[model samples]
Target: MQNLARAVLVLFGLLVLAVACIAVSIEGSEPSVPLTEEDVIGTWQGDRGARLEVTADGRARLSDASGWRCFKDGQAGVFTGEGSWIMAQHSDEGPGILVKFTVDGAPATQCSDHFAIHRADTRDGGDVWARWLGTGSKEPYRRTPTG
Candidate 1:
């Protein structure tokens, strides 16, 4: 009975350590600098055929030629949405933005609602990168060239 109890305690300790490691990995690093509307305003295209158009007036439009994996509410195929956005500092993730919008003219889904964009590159025709709020994976976006 004592051996069984010791094994259970060891398992619990391993579980706790695993959770702590996950938490640390998910936390975002400090931003090099604050992000502004002007910095984000423009047409950004993702590698996955996703496009984001942020306007100076706090308006945003999102379109995905191929349905986004993040939207798992049976929302697939060409999707378009319009919504408002704002830049804010996350307690654990440094700087980020919260975008509230509906998909397919339906009520907004919970997924892909927030993004933590890092200001790592200079704002002049440089690549801007962002990631989902709770995940460490990043997606790179480039500004569409204008005439």
Candidate 2:
């Protein structure tokens, strides 16, 4: 009985440690250098037709830049709009970008979305931005060559 208990404890400890390591890798640390508005000014593309542009003038442009199953009002359509954005740094949130844009101007009828952008570590090239989708998930956007 004692041996079995010890083995179970050891396995649980190992499992916890593995999970912690994975969590750390997934929630990466702040960039080596703090992010700046100028640094993020460019075009970022992601899966689907999503594309985001951070202009030097503190504006953001979007093209098909919403979650999957894009909808307008009660209908369906891709999203495109322009809005203001800024580099935001909070003690708890670390460094991130807050983009507040609306899709009313687009041909689409009605829908809304917001973005909380953060830096994510990648295997190659520059760091990507993780656009949080509520508290459940995130979408990673990488800078494109043509943007």
Candidate 3:
């Protein structure tokens, strides 16, 4: 009886040690690399044909075909109904560019949908855009007109 109890205790200890080792290993693992602007520079088509694209030379072009516009890093342009944007930084959230339009024309931060844009719909849209490729998710973004 004594040996059986000791065996069980030993087994429990080993299990606990193994679990702790695994937890530590997981915790020590490196964080995932943040997506960059270059990774998100391409035409992105949404469910409703909402297309967005970031060019290689640091230009963001978005439009609904009938209506299209572009902007540069320090540049700003009209968005949806009453919105505009000013390109910003490229952070871990993804290649981010500042948006200045409606919502008060305040600086709106937009990250590349490729990294962690959340919503599956958004991700799908991003996939269509394909900006998350070549770019390292750390490249600068500038809004520039297509024409």
Put down candidate 2 lDDT per residue, 1-147, tens digits, no spaces.
999999999999999999999999766664565666655678878666678888888888777644433344434445566677777754455665666565645554332234445655433455556463432124566667653
lDDT winner between candidates 2 and 3? 2
Write down the TM-score of every candidate.
0.58, 0.55, 0.32
Residues 1-147 of candidate 3: C-alpha lDDT, one tens digit per residue: 999999999999999999999999977643344445544545455444445554566545444422222223534333332223334443554334442222223345342223122221333432212222221222222222233
lDDT score for candidate 1 against the true structure = 0.65
Q: Residue 145 of model 1: what lDDT?
A: 69
TM-score of 1: 0.58
The better candidate by TM-score, 1 or 2, is: 1
Estimate every model's Cα lDDT from 0 to 1. 0.65, 0.61, 0.40
Question: In model 2, what lDDT does residue 82 have?
Answer: 66
Winning candidate number (TM-score): 1
| Segments of candidate 3 deviating more than 4 angstroms | 1-31, 65-147
Order the numbered candidates by TM-score, best leading: 1, 2, 3
RMSD of 2: 6.4
Pairs that clash in candidate 2 = 73-110
